[model samples]
Target: MVGFNGKSNSAKQIIHRMRRGPTLPDGGVNFECHCVSHLVASPCGYEFREAIKCQKAASEGELEEGACADELMNFMRCAIRTECFRSW
Candidate 1:
């Protein structure tokens, strides 16, 4: 007897992988000013990831005052200090 299979093998395919980085937003990491792809490969990638993670973990109302303030601050500082995000 044949066993029943659920998802198709084709379903496991990665349509479009981001530019080798920590999980970024659907399109990319949007800084309001711009969106980045190869962030994980960049200098300030870790800082950005930490900030996003903190923000995502916050409860519904907790973000009102500020949930990931420290993480966000750290990311901002890294960005400024490294000046890695310059417009091409």
Candidate 2:
């Protein structure tokens, strides 16, 4: 079964299979960023949004406090690899 972070032997196998052949959905990691200048200006809203993303990423095995999206993705990749290795 896939873990909370969505990583598992099956997940690895699926990724490998997808890499070997083209398939529907054109799968790979996709990221979305929301920019709310108005909300960021508010102290409570800024804290709330940041907290939500931090918690979500934490639950998904991503490192907290990434300075940028690229850093966050890299952190998640490393975290997933580390978890996989530990499981083995």
Candidate 3:
């Protein structure tokens, strides 16, 4: 996503940084160095990682199947909103 400065940051950098350390309450790791502008434009990457965790748990019978759909929908909705509203 493009930062407030209008420079694009690599999705790979964002995703990799998010996955590099311990998980947060949202189930994805947070990085201190991430651009706040990027985070504001796209919150779904974190949510999507969380939903993937939920889906995996459901698939393993650790969580109810019904719960997975809701989380998945949340991920999708956030993704669409982020893409649609992105500054560039």
Candidate 4:
């Protein structure tokens, strides 16, 4: 999907946007960095990294089978607790 910076969001980065934020004054895109500085400096950064690494290594079957589920869950919890993935 397109990010808030006009960059094409990589599949991996797209995972960071659990929910879409309000539209920017201008349209944009998410690339390797996932766009938001909130995430860049998040306390959840480590969890996010672990999840992405798991996602990248999983095969389609493994991914669908939830091989990365734990990692993703950890990241999600961290994101929520830290409010680092806010849509606002």
Candidate 5:
């Protein structure tokens, strides 16, 4: 996502930084960074990574669309959770 100065940062970096924040009483964590989008995106980072792996497998012909169904759903769910349509 774009930083305050309009520079782009990796999803992994954003997610990691956000996850470093303190855990709340409600079993949630608060982020320390100023990237508001990351706050929402962090929770879905694992799913995003899984989706990437699935895509890579598909691109290499090691996986088919049908095989990627679960990964695709997970990716979509994470995207929805983060409200980050461009989560990748």
Candidate 6:
């Protein structure tokens, strides 16, 4: 009686909720390059995501190359600027 009993929440409603954007809070939209958790919020997020996908594809032989080098460099730069990362 406390949870979905199939009456209050229909299957369609559940599916719609699941179809929403990234699982991360704030709609997963990071607006800065703070380098939190090794990922830049803005452009780096997209680049890093693609790089990871490419790496996976390479490991699986689905691609002739591995992760993106350009994005990796950008990530390094961002990491250096981050205060907690200790760029020294």
Best by lDDT: 4
Predictions ranked by TM-score, top down?
Answer: 1, 4, 3, 5, 6, 2
Estimate the overall C-alpha local distance difference test score of candidate 5: 0.60
lDDT of 5 by residue, 1-88 (tens): 8977798989997787556634434534333334433433566766755665565546545554376778779878877876765535
- Which pairs clash in the backbone of model 2? none
Off by over 4 Å in 5: 1-41, 59-65, 85-88
lDDT (0 to 1) per candidate = 0.65, 0.44, 0.60, 0.68, 0.60, 0.50
Each candidate's TM vs. the true structure? 0.59, 0.21, 0.39, 0.53, 0.38, 0.32
Per-residue alpha-carbon lDDT of candidate 1 for residues 5-88, written as tens digits (9 for 90 to 100): 553444224233223344355744344322443665579888877877677678769888878898989988998898898887
Q: Report the C-alpha lDDT of model 3 over 16-63, residue by residue, as the tens digit.
A: 756554445566434342433344335675766667666645655545
For model 6, give the 10-residue run with minimal summed lDDT.
29-38
Cα lDDT for residue 7, model 5?
86
> Per-residue lDDT for 1-88 in model 4, tens only?
7888999998778765654542232433221333544454588867866776677668999998879999989988887887865778
> Could you give the candidate ranking by lDDT, starting with the highest?
4, 1, 3, 5, 6, 2
In model 2, the runs with Cα more than 4 Å from the true position are 1-35, 60-88
Clashes of each: 0, 0, 0, 11, 0, 0
Could you tell me the TM-score of candidate 2? 0.21
True-structure Cα RMSD, model 1: 7.8
What is the lDDT for 9 in model 5? 88
Give residue 62's lDDT in candidate 4 (0 to 100).
93
Residue 51 local lDDT, model 6? 58
lDDT string for model 2 (1-67, tens) is 5756777668677665445422224542112212333333443443434544554446343443443
